[model samples]
Every structure is written in structure tokens, then in C-alpha cells.
Target: MPTRRRFIKCLIALGAGLLPWSGWSEMLKIVNHQAAQAAILTNDSSAKTLDLIHPKDVSYLYHTAADDISALTASDFQGRRAGTVGEEKAAAYLIEQMKGLGLEPLGDLINKNTRNYSNAFTVYPVIEEFYNGRLTFRPGNSQDLRTPCANVIGGIMGKNKSESVILSAHFDHLGIFQGHLYPGANDNASGVGCILDLVRQLVQEGVKPKCNIVLAFWSAEEMGFVGSFSFLQNPTFSLGGLKAVFNVDTIGNGALNDFSVWASSDNEAVQAIQSAASEHNISIPLASHEGYNSDQVYFNLDHLPAVTLMARDWLNKNHTPDDVPDFVNPEKVALANKILYKAVKKIAY
Candidate 1:
């Protein structure tokens, strides 16, 4: 591992290739570090905060995912189904990104170079098809097909390692169906994008958490949360050691600047997130309800702290070919990224 100074310098060395303007290079420096050691919340319930994290930092923390979504949802991805060529491409890209960002390997994995950064498993996909708004699983015979899948994991170590906050998003989506490709840009590509961008910031900005922050890109989620559930069953770290789980899914659409964090009303993570969202003035709403569609369901079922931020118009072109990149709002995607980052900081910092 590089020294903290070298890691910070790596941010600068990432260089001008991705910057919209080369002159903005100076702006990317860590000019403000007040938020680094803040308590993350105030004594007063209404006064939570993450100080001096400028607005453009959201773009810096978010654009990569947007750019990644474009790549991940492109023709190369073929909708990113588990055990397929498209899914393998997506996993390779995630491993490459994790390596580039200098995150530590959490545990063992099928690929030695990837370490725990890539966990491959044999998952039974729960294929669903909808007709006239009625959803049904594919036939019994089809259910017998078990395929090898991969999940990408990485994290930032904090001062306290006994417990950690998890930031997750599934990278898998429905592959081609009935001869039409399902782009799955908003269904999940957007969520994975957010995870990538946040981890990138934690890596480059030298912002260490008080508790470790674990980032996971689940596989085979489209197959009924198999990836997340599998990890929960056999995680490198203990499930009991988890402080909270923040999941992002389908965050690329519905009201250009608005999003919703879905969770049960009694869940404490919701209130903490509400306070954090208020402090940051992020354009996000908390929708208190149990959601069975996304990966948060398993955590919620186990009575663990879990919440997911997703686009309100998640049904728009969802699981279909129309969930393409040109339709996503970069600004809105950036806002969701900001809210998730802030929420994670509130919990771990």
C-alpha cells in the first residue's frame, strides 16, 4: 500500500484525461479538510453535517459512475447477466477499477489477483417475465439452470475495524429476452455507478472513515438477490459486525433532481439518513416501506440496518431495452451520489 501522501498524490496523478477542462486540475486539490474529523452529527437532532464538501466534489465523486454506466450498459455488457460474457466483462472492469483505486482485498476469491475483490458463485437465476403487469417466474425446468456468477467487493479501512458500514449496489441486470436486449441502465447500472464513484473519492481524497466503509457490487441480484444473500451467508467479515447497510439501485431517473431512500418506517437507518439528507440539503426523500424487489430486502428481513436510494421512476423502461444511457441525467445521478456519500459519512464518520 502507498503512504497516505502517495495515495493523495495519486488523485493528482489521475491527471487531466477525465477533467472537462484541464485548468480544473487545481480545483481538485484537497483545499478543505474540515469534514475529515467532524463528529458527523450535532447534539441537536436537526443539525447533522459534513462540512465544506463543495458541490463540484459531487461531480468529481459521481461522473465516473455516469461514464461507467455508459460503458457498462453499452453493447459490450449485453445487459450484464451472471455467468455470461457481458457479466464477465463487467466484473473484469470492476476488478481493474478496484485495483487502480488501491483498496485492500477483504478475503479470498476465485481469481487470486482479485482476492476477495471478486467472489464467484454458482447461482440459480430467478428469471421473471411480466405480461399485463402480472409477474411470474420462468418455468420449473428453467429454474434448474445454475450458473457461475461474480460479485465485486472493496473498501476503505477506518480507525475502527471491528465494525463497518456497507455501501452496496448490484451490477447484474436482466440479459436479453425474447430477442431484445435489456439495457438495464437505471435498473442497476446506475446504482453500481454510484458505488464506483464514492469509493473513488474515498481513495483519492484521503478521507478515512471512523469505521471502515465496505463497497460491494452484487451479482445475480436480478435473480432474486442471490448475490447479496449469498454474501450475507458467508461474508469475509461478520454480519454481526455491520453497523448499517446503504444500498443504491435504479437511481438514474424520475424528477431530474429527486430520489428516494426506501426502508421500513421503524428502521433507525432511515432517521439517520433523513438527518444527514437534511444537513446536506440533498434532493432526496425517504420512503418508508418494505421493498421486496431490491437487495435490501434480505438485510431488512434479518433486522439489520439497511436502506436503498433509488430513482422514483424506476419502472420507466425498467428491465427493458429503453433503459439506455442517453436518457440518464448526469446532474441527478450526481445528486444521488452526493446523498449516498453523505449518508455513509454520517454513519461511519
Candidate 2:
């Protein structure tokens, strides 16, 4: 809200008595101008394209908390309905949609009898026996239950296997607690929407990657990256061929104008993201290993590079009931998806 002239005037006043007011003001202007010019120097520092995805649709992704997300937050165990039932339902629905989008199955997973979709992975197992009742307030901890948990993953094999990329999001969310249900409208349903939208875009645009593109919808991420970890343990494709992984963990929590990127310096995904961001004039709150978190962890652990891009700071409504659909900014999610598509086009190709 503060004007450039006012900013310079303040700077001049701060530097007064040390130099002439006129000279200080001139020097401040030159410094400010140079700073602004410096911002334009790098290709990865500017936003070039944004229309790749629509703004209104992005808003829709955030505000539409359709379907249940409680599955991600459910406490299931081995052999039992590990995690949440809602999560399992979400995974099933995602697989059906991916198949509808024409993604080919890479191998036999989960049931092993079927090769139609990616296998399921478990993030955490709820040992019902651990509940002392009085010690913890969470439900069903008193019963021993082995819940079978899994995340749905699919991919379009790239022309060049060695240069593959991953586009991922978590589809599971907090289940019902007591008599109430946590719809998880924005806590992550928004991310799933963005992912789905991208799938629609790829199918419509006939965009094929030089490198394989993995559409990953992680499970149990809310339980400490369980589903992602499981998938990495037994991936359908060779991890050696991976170039980078792009994760969309949460993007509809805030207004559409702001976005954030968490990337590891140890990988090449950082440059790819920076390049796309700059070209589209997108502003990214950048980071290195210090604050990077998302489904990209699997690749990072395997020494493969990756990035986590989102539209807003998820901590505000993260893990809370307030993370509903209305609080999400759809335009931001759409833009993030657009940027992601651009990044894929540049990096994988």
C-alpha cells in the first residue's frame, strides 16, 4: 500500500544527517531502481505464463469439498481398514478416474491379481490395543485393528524414460470424529482437484512428456508420509530413471494470488520450477532443504530431486476443522496447476 516515493522519502530520512537530503534522496532512488532492475535479471525470477490454467476453476478446486476426505485421517491397521474408510474410498475413486483418463497400468500392485492401477501404500497402522482410554482421547485406540491402507498412483510413460517427472497430490483426508465428519474441503481436497484438473488438461491438450509422468495421489501423508514411503519402497517403475518429482500437497487454503514452493537444493527440480515461475511472472516463496516437505520425499530419499508447490501457507487451516472449502482460494490452485504444467513441459521435455 505504501508508494515508492514514500518508501524513498523514509529511507532518505533514515539516512539524514549522514548525507545531504537531496543527495540521499537521489541515492536512495538509484538504489531502489537498481534493486528493481536486478529482479528482472534472471529468467527464473519472473512469471511469464499463467493462462495455462483458468483462475475461476482454480477457485473451484479450493471451495468444492465434495466427496469425503476422512479416509486420510482414519486410524487403520495391518489387515484391517488401516487409516480411514473414507481414504480407501477416495483411493478407489481416484483410480477409476485415472483409468477413465486413459492412464496405463505399470504393474501388479495391492491385490496382485489385478494390474489395472497402482498398488496401495500404508502410512500408519493403528494398533487398537494401544489405547488405554483414559490416556488418549482419540477413538478406537482400545481395539486391535489392522487397517489396510494404500495410495493410488498412475503414469503416462514418457518418450524418454531417463527424464521422467512426477505430478503428485494426496487424496485422503480427516474422517469422522465422534458424531461429526471432517470433510477436509481445503485441507487437501483442493489439491486433489488441482491434480484432477491437470489430468483433464493433459488429456485434452494431448500433451505427452519426453519423460514419464507419474500421477501420484498419496495416502496416509497426514500420518507421517506413510503412503508415499510405501510406494517408494516398491515402485512400479525404476527409480533410477527418475529426473524429478513435483508434489501438490495443499494449494487451496488461501487466496489465489499467493503461492509457495518448497524444493530441495540437492536436486534439479529447483531450477525447473524457477524457470517456469520466472517465465510466468509467478512469485514463489522459495526454500531449500530447511523447509521442504511433500510427496517428493520418496524421490529425495532415493537421491532423486523433487519440488513441492502449493498456492498458500497450509499451516493456517492445516489439521483443523476450519480447513473447509469456502476458505480456499480457487484461482490460486488453478494458477499453481498451470505453473506445474509449464514446469513439466520444460523439465521433462
Candidate 3:
């Protein structure tokens, strides 16, 4: 049997068109249904029986999430900082994954091009200065600096194309600060992995949502939610019909079984998340508060009902060099994926 790393590499190569589908037949067999069933039955006694979707399906998705985290945290991506070559590489990788999953590009809808998966934007980051013990932000000029970044957007159309639900996570981290690498595995890569696996599970199960499901991999979130704000300013879809935005971030750390949720308001979206948790037998301690940071902040500022799911004890390694894949727990990431999957399904389906 091929190792998981080799299997993931083959999948990436296949998605990038470097390998033909016929050539990957043998490698694809590594994920055979029988193997998945055996793995689940042996590993998780509770999953010996089936549920809404096959337990084996969940196992496959879980492995995919782990693979995604590994890929994102790899050194080749250079911490995936916005405007850097590493970030570009990460975006290309994500585009290939989206294409492989049969998701349509939701970026650059006007231009039917190969690079349409990227929603390009420029960020003239504001310069902050402390004046008289008060922090102030000034408009960046040419003397300052400007960074070119893009958000990778993909989606699956639903029965009602007019309405949409967004499942988003930021893909950018603090590049390399002072000669140290911040892998950002738990800070956000975990969230991105969970969303990718959620999409994979939805596609594999042939689930047709009631509203369009947009998978947004935001960029430059560390620079104050720039990518999401850019999307709002120039949206490719109708914002009026947006049902809700479910954001996941920093779920790979802290207690494995403990989860926290912050919503813009106590709306149907929150209720949907709570109901999903209940149905899925996951415990989510709901905490409603204002000014919770993450990619969801922009949407909340626009009066959109959005909810963010995260775990505790993330601040210690958030932007440090210690934030690496070694510290991320696959089970915690898998749990986050399951909760988001059910919650999004409750709303979109």
C-alpha cells in the first residue's frame, strides 16, 4: 500500500494534470471502500455501524483533512504569506483541489479564464503609529508599501441559485517574521483543511444543497481581514440572498473535545449551528460576543449573520515559530470538520 504522503502527492499530481487518470488507478485503489470500512471498524468502535452517510465516508474525509493540513503546513508553501510566491503556490494548489472536487470558480465570473479561481486585489496596508500612547492608522502612500494578493473562491451551485451560504477560512499567515517560520497550522491551516474536507464529503455524498455553497479561502486575513473585505466590496454573487457565513479558525489546539462559537447575533444561523451540534453529538459552548476577530469580522460589520467556530488556548502559538503541524491534533481537526459539515448542511441543505 502506498503511504499517506505518497497517496496525497499522487492525488496532487493527478489534480494538476501531471498524471493521467488511467495512470492513477492503482494509487486510487488505496482508498478502496473495503479498506476504508476496515480502518473505521478497527479504529472507531462507535463507527462500526453506519449513519446518514457511511462511516467509511467520514473516515475518508478525515484522512483528507489530515492530508490537507500536512500539505498546507509544508515548508514549500513558505507559510503562505500574502503577496509572496509561497502564497501564490498555495492558491494554485487550492485551485487544483477545487477543480478536482468539481467546484466551479466563483472568482472573476466575468472573465472565463484558467486563472479565474483567483479574485485578485491590492492591499495598501495602513501604517500604524503610536502617538501620545494612542495607536493611529494612516493611509499608506507610495513611500509606504502595497501588497498584491488574491482570494481563492470556488462554489457548488444548489437548487436555488439565488441564495448562497459561505463556508470560509483564511489561508494566509505571518510569512517569515525575523528569520523564523510560522507554519500557522493551528492558526488557520486547520480551518482551511476542515472546509476542504467538508466540500469533499458533500461532493462525494452527492448532496445538493438548497442554496449555493461558496468555499472561500481568504487571503491577507492577518493584515486585518483584507481579502474578505475586498470580496464584499466587489462581490461576484448577490449578497442580499446570502443566508449565512460559517467561518472556522484555530481549531487544532487546546482541549480536543472543547469547542467555542461566536456569532454576530442570536439568529437562525446560530440556532442551526447549535442544532447541528446536538444532532451530531458534538458539544459546542456557544458564546455570543461583539468584536470577535477572524475572517468573519468583515461580514459581521456588514450586518451579515455569521458564526465562527474555534478552540481555546490558541494564542500561545498563534503567530509564533512554534505553530507547526507537529502541534496540531488530527482528531481535533476532524471533529471541527464534522461539526461544520453538519451545521452548513442544516443551513444550506
Q: Write the per-residue lDDT of candidate 2 for residues 84-165, one digit (tens) a residue.
A: 5556656666676666666766544546554646565434343222122211112334345445676677776666766567
lDDT tens readout by residue for model 3, 70-181: 8887888998878888889889988878877778788876556543788999777655444443223345675656878899998888888899999999998766655767
Q: What is the per-residue lDDT of model 1 for residues 169-222, given as tens digits with 9 covering 90 to 100?
A: 999877776777787888788888877887767655555678878888889887
What would the TM-scores of all predictions be?
0.79, 0.68, 0.76
State each model's CA lDDT, in order: 0.71, 0.59, 0.75
Top model number, TM-score: 1
Predicted structure 1: lDDT: 0.71
Q: What is the TM-score (0 to 1) of candidate 3?
A: 0.76
lDDT of 3: 0.75
Candidate 1: residue pairs that collide: none
Candidates ranked, most accurate by lDDT first? 3, 1, 2
- Which of 2 and 3 is the better model by lDDT? 3
Model 3, poorest ten-residue lDDT window? Answer: 50-59
